[model samples]
Target: IYKHSGELVAKHAFRVASGLDSMVLGETQILGQLKSAVRTAELAGTLGPKLRQLFDASFSVAKFVRTETDVGAHSVSLAAASVKVGERIFGSLSNVNVLFVGAGEMNRICAEYFVSYGIQNISCSNRTLSRAKDLAETLSGDYFPLSDVAHKLEKFDIVLSCTGSPIPVLGKRAIEKAIEARRHKPILLIDLAVPRDIELEASELEDVFLYTVDDLGEIVNDGMRNREGAAREAEKIIVERLVQFKSQLDRKKRIPVIKKFRKRGELIVQIELEKALSSIAKGERPEEVVKVLSRAISNKFMDEPSRALNNDSTGEKLSLSEALERLYGLNKN
Candidate 1:
């Protein structure tokens, strides 16, 4: 593990929270994950006050970056890319019938992306019709059984398939026949599964435009490249916010020392004032009493600090003496 002290620690966390260090560069989901981890630690009684402040500062920096710059603009996720490719082929998706195969997480996300893009007609199919129906209801669409996909394929203008099946759920012949039934009106097929829910051979058929996960990844990468400028802008914002946060952190660290120093000075003032009053009551000259009081107060305040300086090792003493001089603005004088 790497160790960073003072401001560097906050710099690292702020950059990561803002997605500057992410693989997709400006990807923003990681910030949410960090917040979730923070909540877990809070629930377990592990996060201290200082650590909580650091995370809170990082979150503030992330939100500021999002507002001031386009760091999270042009999202490069696969779900968004699927919609991009659909628009490329069909001009617009408002009139298209979308078939979402496999009501799994990936398919559900893609279905949501399509619906959010204003695609009115969509259907869901799964091995278990209940899951598909649930997803369909969530999207306000219709549901069909996986077994019926082959015969019903022609009804959809776009087919998005992602499943955990070890074998292909869609074959070349199935797509080919669907094209014939559609009178070759052109169909867009997006396969986002690892084992490939749609057969690779389906790409060879006419009027069947197929895109795999790798293809969408390339589109996402193109988006990542386009966001480089925004990422740099966010980096600049981090540097500015880091400096401001560091100053605030330093002041917070000094608060206890400031309180103790003020308390000790007050005690010295009270003790010396009593001594001065006694001398005046004993018939000492006013000048003599005032002179003695001032000298006593100064010596008493300096006594502990003088001893501390004398007790330190040579190097520590020199550094501490210089710091004290600067703190008192003695060097400036």
Candidate 2:
């Protein structure tokens, strides 16, 4: 129902899928999101040949940008930013005890970043114990139920929560108790959830360093500015890709025309060949049959153009003869 022109829509979709329009510039998540959308459209049979071509070209462009540019050379993902913030607070992530409060995609990505620093003391707690256990095992960490999160909170120095909880999962009172149990040691609490897994009041606690999704946007913006040069290079690549996509679409559109033309020519050849063979079978002269075949073929090929030229009723300045002469590059002499 959106009424953008095809060129504009293609450009916008390509930019978004390529991460040029992302909050975290050059982040890989948007590519996956775009792929998922395309797959869904394909499954629903709504992705026709043209759309398939466009999206395929888009994927190629995204891959080209990622491989050819340094756009994603920093911590652009919010999950990755959490690890950076943790390192900033503790100097090194390897020595810190990290507790991921969810086993979803974001938490998994965050855990991977932390584990890359060789952080051995990692834990995951989720409503579904199996999913949490799977995530913990992948990171070589421990898993606990959501109910045990409050009691176990004091054990970890850095806690990152990304969940779909409607209400705040960790309240100020709960975090304050954890800080007390930890002898007032500072805890980095990253709330990646939309509704906020950690209560807003927890930010007021002196020992609880709380950061929400909005806070992460500042880091993501800094990354975007840093990659501006790479983004410019990516835009150049997109221009090239756009040219290629349009050329391909034009060529595809001409396929039926090309086929029809070729079929008509082949049919004319068959008719001429049949007439020449019939004359030979009737004992007509071989040289005469050859002359008749060539003449018949030429006439058949030019019949439509001759008829169109003769039927020109309008007294245009550029007559049909002049048009045909120009079209065929005929010498006036």
Q: How far is candidate 2 from the true structure (C-alpha RMSD, Å)?
A: 8.5
Write the residue-wise lDDT of candidate 2 on 1-333 in tens digits: 456687877787678778898876787778998899999999999999888887888898898888998787666668777877887788866678989998899899888977876888999999999999999999989999999999989999999999889998899999999999999999999999988899999989987899898898798777667688789998988888888888888898999988998999999999999999999999999999999999999999899888887677766435877877896889656
Per-model CA lDDT versus the true structure: 0.90, 0.87
lDDT of 1 by residue, 1-333 (tens): 678997899999999999898877777779989999999999999999999999999999999988988777765889888888888899977999999999999888878878777887989999999999999999999998999999999999999999899999999999999999999999999999999999999998888999999999898887877778888888889999998998998899999999998998998899889989998999999999999899999898778778989999999999989988987888783
Candidate 2: clashing pairs of residues? none
CA shift of 202, model 2, Å: 24
Q: lDDT, candidate 1, residue 28?
A: 71
Worst 10-residue lDDT window, candidate 1: 66-75
Tell me the TM-score of model 1: 0.64
The candidate scoring highest on TM-score is 1
